[model samples]
Target: MATSSRSASTPGWPVSGAQSRPPAAQGAGGWTWALTAPLLVFLAIAFLGPVLLMLARAVSDAELPSAWPQTAQLLRDWDGNGPPDDRLAAALGTEILAARRAGTLNRVANRLNYDLVGSRSLVYATGDALERGASVRGFADLARIDRRWINPAVWTAMRHAAGPRTSFYLLASVDRRLDGDGRIVQVEREQAVFVDILLRTFLISAVVALLCALLGYPVAYLLATLPSRWANPLLILVLLPFWTSALVRTTAWVVLLQTHGVLNEALIGMGLIETPLALIYNRLGVYIAMTHVLLPFLVLPLYGVMKGISAAEMRAATSLGAGPLTVFLRIYLPQTLPGLLAGMIIVFTLALGYYITPALVGGGADQMVSGSIAFYTNQSLNWGMAAALSLLLLVPLTLMLFAGRYLTKSVPV
Candidate 1:
């Protein structure tokens, strides 16, 4: 009894042995890890695994090496200067013939075509010539098979591709490529579309996020300040869109924003305009649809934060001779900023990757990076390009998320 009293009085001291729990009870504490183990394993396999695979696909360059092993090895040593040597030319010809017989020449050709257009036919024609007994002892003989075989650009592309990894996909995604001298250069203005697409993606996402904040702040404030009877119904209305499919909502916007649609007809009946506005199939429609869809995301989080703020604080400020605008700007706005930042980040990141609404409602000028990613994945089957574009999209979002997290932590509630 004396030892137990001492154990209870002395902090950080071990309990008396007589008072300690059984060994079985002590072991039960380990169940915490056991309970969480399944979640850790699931996240590793489902999320981390695919993210690593995407990173690998963006940089892996195995097509040429897999299809033309010997030639790829030889080309790796070549400086990618003027032209290939006699031995390198002969090896390339031999490997092309071997790959043709093995039915893998198409893979090498298709990979090369990614670097230089028309390279597929160039590779196929040369393979056919070599198969037809066109002896290739040097660059001259290979050139006879196909004149493009002598072009430094083709050889440079081949040398660039002779790798266990390459930056071609990542570079191409940003409208850049290696020149014959192995220096990075901008692609021709005509071919430089990805940069524009990427900029347009960010611009559209920023606009949508801004619109959501502007439209959602008052709605969320009302939801927080109104009486419970009114607030409950209003919140349900805000959440109603979540129950419907995003695709269905987007399609409904299309119907409402079209030239002869309800909005235009209503305006016309009130003599608002002489002709139907070009609202649909443009940037305006993209803003309208995305803002409507993402407004709840902003409102819900902001409303949650706003509800936590004390009405007494605002009243105290007002009693101290503060005006309504002064009370809000100096007292309330700072408290709600973290929630606003969270909602804006959520809406912005979602808008960054938006594909369907923009594709459906906006014209050709409004296609985002996701459209290009989808085109590469489904149509062109260029997994590298798709993965590279995905990384470009992920990088900015990750930076913004980190910044928002820092701001939320630093700002006083």
Candidate 2:
């Protein structure tokens, strides 16, 4: 065989193999970078950056350490099994004098009081007692001012408060804590708020999702089964809410569902009731408004999925002597499962984060996790607790989203 000499400098190829390699690599890399840059920037600015900043604030313990670094450090070594050491007492005394001189004692006391009810008066009294020549020997002297000061539980909380950083806000969200001896314990029933809020949030979300699915299923079927001209217009109407501002929609619902609104007026006109019912400021109004807002989310997904399904299979089933209900249950319904699941996931996830509707329509008992988050953020200015609560909400939401995806993949079309 005559070996044709393959010149490295061939015009069709490259002078060296290395010369060809770089262009291919560069093209691939350039495309990857071009595709990924937007996503990375979006995540950095929108998702990851905010989340990290919020998480940092959750454990910040900003006020305590900024006010009394020495006292905080002294408490670090405290076992909290019994009285704190004299060094801790002295450190507290020193910090108190310094805080008083700096005029930050009241601010620090106020900050602590936000976390622990009545802590402001306790800290102020402790400072006064120290100034009046109270013995700075041990926790016993601190207890003389407020009996709660002696409790191991109180000391544990103090140690956390004195930290350069702390997990108190995170722990408190789940009704958990490091007790006096530094052992994790269930928070007292009266202090346990998050668990109830979490449960209520999930319960409300589940109810909304179910209601949406039930109401949307028939509507989606109608849209899918109808003529395209009619279905398209109806679909536009269904999606009309998306174009409107959420606040406006919620406010409209508030006005419409109120006792004196059109609904009650109609009821009275029809002689359905003797008097106007308590509709707006309750769970019933919350459900009504949320269902109205979220039903489209359920319908669109289901309608889209149902639209793609071939009608021939259902026709074949019907031709085989299968009844209408039987054909729907066996052939049609199974195909709509993906839509049902997607709608449920969307409705449930959105409902979990609902704030405005519940705030406007629901009473205190119906308030969801998002309402609690807003309360911490706006009312209390407790960003740490707000972030922790938000994180708690995120976990289950992420799980549900992934579970939805998994279901979509595993379920047969």
Error (Å) of candidate 1 at residue 252 is 0.8
Task: List lDDT for all candidates, in order.
Answer: 0.91, 0.84
Question: Which tens-of-lDDT digit does each residue in 70-183 have in candidate 1?
Answer: 888988887765678899988888888999999999888888999999999999998888888888899999888888876888898898888889999999999999998888
The window of 10 residues in a row where model 2 has the poorest summed lDDT is 1-10
Best by TM-score: 1
TM-score of 1: 0.92
Off by over 4 Å in 2: 1-30, 103-107, 126-153
The per-residue C-alpha lDDT of model 1 at residue 16 equals 75
At residue 295, candidate 1 shows an lDDT of 91
Candidate 2: clashing residue pairs, number: 0
Query: How accurate locally is residue 316 in candidate 2, as Cα lDDT from 0 to 100?
Result: 95
Question: Candidate 1: which stretches are off by over 4 Å?
Answer: 1-30
